[model samples]
Target: MAEKKWMPRWFYQLASPRWCYQITGKLLPIFAVAALILLVGGTAWALIYAPADYQQGNSFRIIYIHVPSAILAQSCYMMMAVAGAIGLIWKMKVADMVAKACAPIGASIAILALATGAIWGKPTWGAWWVWDARLTSMLILLFLYLGVIALNSAIESEQTAAQATAVLALVGLVNIPIIKYSVDWWNTLHQPATFTLTERPAMAMEMWLPLLVMVIGFYCFFAVVMMLRLRNEIIQRERRSSWVRELISG
Candidate 1:
C-alpha cells in the first residue's frame, strides 16, 4: 500500500540527499517569510514593549537575544549529533548533508550566545568573562561546533568526515547537561531560567511575555537559516545529479 502520511515512515529511505533537498526546498519560502515577520516583529516588541526588570532595569533586555541564542546553540548541537548518528549508522546521504548543513548555523548561534552572554555579564557580574560552570560548558559547546565544522571541511570524503564529526558531537553531548544545570549545579552569577511562557515565570508577565516571543522568534529565525544552509548542502552533495542541475538552472 502507498504511504498514508505525507512523509515516509522509514527514516533511512528518506535520507537521500535528493529527498532532503526537495523537502527543504518546499519548506524554504514558507519558513523564510514567516521567520522574517516573526523575528523582526518579535524583537521590536521585546525591546520596546517589554518592561525593564525590577532589579536590572533596561539592562535585562539582553535576555531577549542572549537566552534564545544560548538555548539554540545547545539544541543545534544535539540535532547535528542525531543527524551524524544516522549517517554513521545507516550510511545515509541526507544524514551527512544535514550534519554538514548544521555546522555553520550552529556556530553562528554559539557566537550570538557568547557575545550576548558577555554583554549581559557586564551589567550583572561587572565582568565580561567568567569561568563559571554554565559559561565554561557553553564555551566548550561552541568549540565543539567549530571542531565539527573544521573536521567535516578538512576531510575529502563525506562518509569519513561525517563519521568523525558524529563521534565528536556525541561526545560533546555531556556538555549539554552541564550547560543547562550549571546555574543550579554551582555558585555562579548567570541567573536561573526566567522567561517561561507555557508555565509561570519568576518575574511578572509585563517583563516576561516579550521575552517569550523573542524565544519563539529566535526559533523561527534558526529554522530559516537552517533551510538556507540545507539548500546549499543539497547543491554541493548532489552536484553530479540531475535534480541539482535543474535546481541550479532554474
Candidate 2:
C-alpha cells in the first residue's frame, strides 16, 4: 500500500515554514471562527444545560473544562517531545518551530488543570492541595515544561536553543508515564475518568455529552492557538529567507 501511493516523495514539504505558513494561513481563520463557535457553544451547553452530578452537584461541571484540559496538557507535552525528537533525529527546522510553539500552550493547560483540580478538591476532599502522587507528578510536569521553555530562551543562538530544548524534552519524557499511572498506581484526591462511554460514565448522558463537546472545543482552540504561535515562530526564524520576504510583501 505504501508503494502504490501517487503522492510526491517530498510530501513532507508541508513541514517547510513557508509552506505551512501559506497553507495554515488559508485555514487559520476558519479554525478561529470554528473555535469561537464551538468553545462558546460548548461552555454554555456544559454549564447551563448539563444535569448536576448526584455526588458533587454543580461542582462536577468543572470537569467540563478541567478533565479535558488536563488530558490535553499531558498529550500536548507528548506532542512537543515528539517534535523535539524529530528535530534531534532529522534536524527538521519546523520540528523546533512546533516545539517552541507548544511550550506556552502546554504550560497554560497544566496551570488550568492544577487550578481546576484545586477548585474541585476543596469541595470534594475538603482541602485545596495535596501531595498525592498524581498531584505531585502534575506539578513536576509543569516544572518540566517551564524548564524546556526556559532552556530554549536562555540560549542566544537559535540552533543552540533548539538543541538544548530538544535534549531537555527528551530527558523530561520520564514524567509522562509517571503522571499517567499516578492516579491508578496510588489512591489520590483526584477522581479517575468519569465520562467513559465504552466502559461506564459516572454521570448521565446529559452531563457527559456536553462535557464532550467542551473537550472537543478545547482541542480545537489548542490547535488554533498553537498554529497561530507557530506561524509567528516560523516568521521569526525564517525572516532571512526569500519566502518570508514574499510573505511579508504579499
On lDDT, the candidate that comes out on top is: 2
Candidate 1 least-lDDT 10 residues: 4-13
Highest TM-score: give the candidate number. Answer: 2
Per-residue lDDT of candidate 1, residues 7-55 (tens digit): 4556645776676767777988887777787778778887888877778
Deviation of model 1 at 34, angstroms: 1.7
Q: Please provide, for model 2 over 1-250, each residue's C-alpha lDDT reduced to its tens digit, 9 standing for 90 to 100.
A: 6754644445367557788888878888888888898889988998888888778888978888888888899889999999988887878898889998999999999999999989988898999998989889999989989998898878988888888988888888899888877778888766676655478676677877787777778888898999999999999888999988886899
Model 1 CA deviation exceeding 4 Å by range: 1-9, 197-199
- Per-residue lDDT of 28 in model 1: 80
Worst 10 residues of 2 by lDDT: 3-12
Root-mean-square deviation of candidate 2: 2.0
Cα lDDT, model 1, residue 90? 78
